[model samples]
Target: MPHPSCARRWAMPKKAKQADLKKLAICVGLGAAIWAIPAPAGVGLPAWRLLGIFLGTIAGIITQPLPLGAVAMMGLGAAQLTGILTFQAAFSAFANEIPWLIAIAFWLSGGFIRSGLGARIAYSIVSVFGKTTLGLTYSLTLAEALLAPAIPSVAARAGGLFLPLAKALCLACGSDPANGTEGKMGSYLMMTCFLSTTISSAMFITAMAANPLAVNLAAETLGYTISWGTWALSALAPGLVCLLLTPALMYVLYPPQVKDTPDAPAKAKEELKRLGPMSRDEKITAFALGLTVCLWIGGQSLGINAVAAALAGLSILLVTNVVTWEQCLSDNQAWDTLTWFAALIAMAAYLNKYGFISWFSDKVVGMVGGLGLSWQAAFGVVTALYFYSHYFFASGAAHIGAMYTAFVSVSIACGTPGIVAALALGQLSNVMGCLTTYGIGSAPPYYGTGYVPQAKWYQFGFIFSVIYLVVWVGVGSAWWKVLGLY
Candidate 1:
């Protein structure tokens, strides 16, 4: 007989396959249900058919019936096979600059981890402000904000850098979930770190994997161009307010039992000492990141495309041997993001091109118009509905794919400014990830630490969701008005 462990491993795949098939059936059922409906007047048959395939693709993304890339590939193949899109059109997004920008940025982000610059920065912050529990949390928040632009994946930053550091800080303070002492400091630290990641993700277009997707969708759906600088500048004020307030709010609401953490700064100092001086690779990575950020900020004025800047930075890293070609190939997340992102962009672009989005937008506008509210009031209602709808979504990318365009359309149709609608919806797309533990890529690992209970997690998630909405809408809107975005 085969070893029991080997037998169990083999059985796991079969069970997973069964579960995947069930989810696949649900996705297919949803597509078929929509596909069977008659195409609306003024919407072509092909556009209607593509909507079904797109919705099914989004379903597959949310339900994870297969790897995201595989599901997207299948969706593209379906679109082509059904004659909704030609072979050339189905694969066209692979050539688009947005997908390549994100993928190249991902590779560039790897330098932070490989060179240990990310950890060094985190440690240096902790060494300064870690004497108090609240201070430690702020240090982590600051570190995260600093790293956000360079690190595209919130999960990688939170899980790989902050989570480990938070756990270490917990142990140093005599707090551990394993010992029923998490409430002392671990719970507060974990919750703050997790919540702050969402804010940092919103602060930059390159901060999260799905952010560029929002940028692409906004441009394609609304004809509102959002450059890297524009996104960063618009978010600067509101994002900073949220970041500064998150630690204090959590401190007040979920106060740590151990307020004075004298050991933390010392621990951080020891960590810094062990890390020693910055290596040559770290210096090179920092220079490359600095050059890239400067370019991203002013490259447009200088006639340098954002994608070109990213490619240039990546090229510098490659030439210096900071990260190898083999390492780039081995980065499954980067490649997978490129694949699904390209597919979704193609589908969404065609949805606009084929006029399905416009038809759907008309229906939504008619419904909202019947309420007879001012456009501001109408936008508020739509924004709230859109923000809270994340309860039904597990992936930000899936949520963006399914709802972002339609909501932006309705907002603009109701007389909301096009840039205002696109940017508001774009920022909320990242902030809304706070609603559930599975809401985004970064939530699970922090929650899985067993520091915060499920009930409290949801409770805090809801509370922060409201807080985020208020800050983004009130403060963000005022700032945008001053900048003449409207």
Candidate 2:
């Protein structure tokens, strides 16, 4: 009481400790609650499986090891146990061409990373652009855009390469990678880097693993073939424009922090220099990745299969001693992702086989009709379904399985552009999944990062979701209409 300053100082540490404890308590409580749920959708698709998703998501948000892939497996097991899904129906994601493609893509990406080619490319970009935060913005966005068309794994695209280097750049720019990023220019930088991967990847047919699946779902289910090249050019134009402008957006979204170091950018450059010359692994990675791109563009006209192209590249990597099978096996995300996608895809096929998704959509259409909305209202309802309907899926491929048929039927009823509607729905699967980091697409790696706080990361995600829903949709609608995709 006699020393006012001492008392004020003394109270701060206790408050800080209490806040940390509170956060821990909240994470634990959420995990427990999710872990304890009853079965969902039925006994096999138990409530606990859904809860496992919740728990896994929570674990990602908190950087905990809650076993997300396990959660997905449990979901499949529930489907089997409860007879909601047959073994073939539940396990087919593993066998599908699409899931295999994604798995293969991850393996290739892993080889590149382990080969040190990824870091070499990253370092090359940084050497050219790491001098300032603004410079870094361009480099980060550009690198991702360039890579988007080739590598389908957004996790590998963003988390493996994008996040690490981007964080290092920010750290070098004197921006703290800690809790204070929100109010600083660094926050905007981080946000933009994260979302840009999603945006740019939206452009190419193979920009994302989901894109091919989405495109195929439309062709097979709706009888239209929107070729790989079309999406690449159409979506890419706007995507590049959006990416180029992200630096400016970040500048406006969060002004430079007063306390941030001015010499941060230079520091990062120096650290990069210390890495010295590129190693053999790095050299192989670059040549292989570059060759992969060349093959992708060239193979399209040469009648080469995309999967075959990937296999060939992977073969080269293994043959050249650029990568080992152990590296491939140790790639937890790659393996786990294949399994995860396979399970969800299997579940999706199951729903289609069982008439569950179509049945549910019929109910929705009937209920939506009862609201007495105008054609525009119907449009909005259908559109909302296109975006928000990802709730029932554990992967983007799964979403298509569950809703592609209904989406096509709705378009037919509304006299909308069938191909456009299909593409829109497919795009929405990605966009909606972006809403929550734990959504079907990017949930795994996102949840596994222990550095960022869950609330904060989610805060970024919510903002990001709104941007995609509002800005991207608005822009994409116009773009699709222009291309007659709408």
Best by lDDT: 1
Instruction: For candidate 2, write residues 1-486 as lDDT tens digits.
Output: 011121111122211212244544555566456556654343344334434433433343334333345546755665566554567766776766554555566666555545544444445555666555576677768877787766665654555445545544443343443334434445656666666666776667676667777777778767777887776655654565566655666566544553334454464456556656777666776666556556655676787655666667777788887766766666565566666656655654555555555556777766765666664456567877766656445566666656766766666566666766666566556656655444544444433322334565566656666666665556776887787674
lDDT of 1 by residue, 180-204 (tens): 8889998998998899999999999
Which parts of model 1 are misplaced by more than 4 Å? 1-19, 131-241, 244-262, 374-377, 382-467, 470-486
The candidate that achieves the highest TM-score relative to the unseen native structure? 2
The lDDT values for all models are: 0.77, 0.57
Question: In candidate 2, what residue range of length 10 has the lowest lDDT sum?
Answer: 1-10
lDDT of 1: 0.77
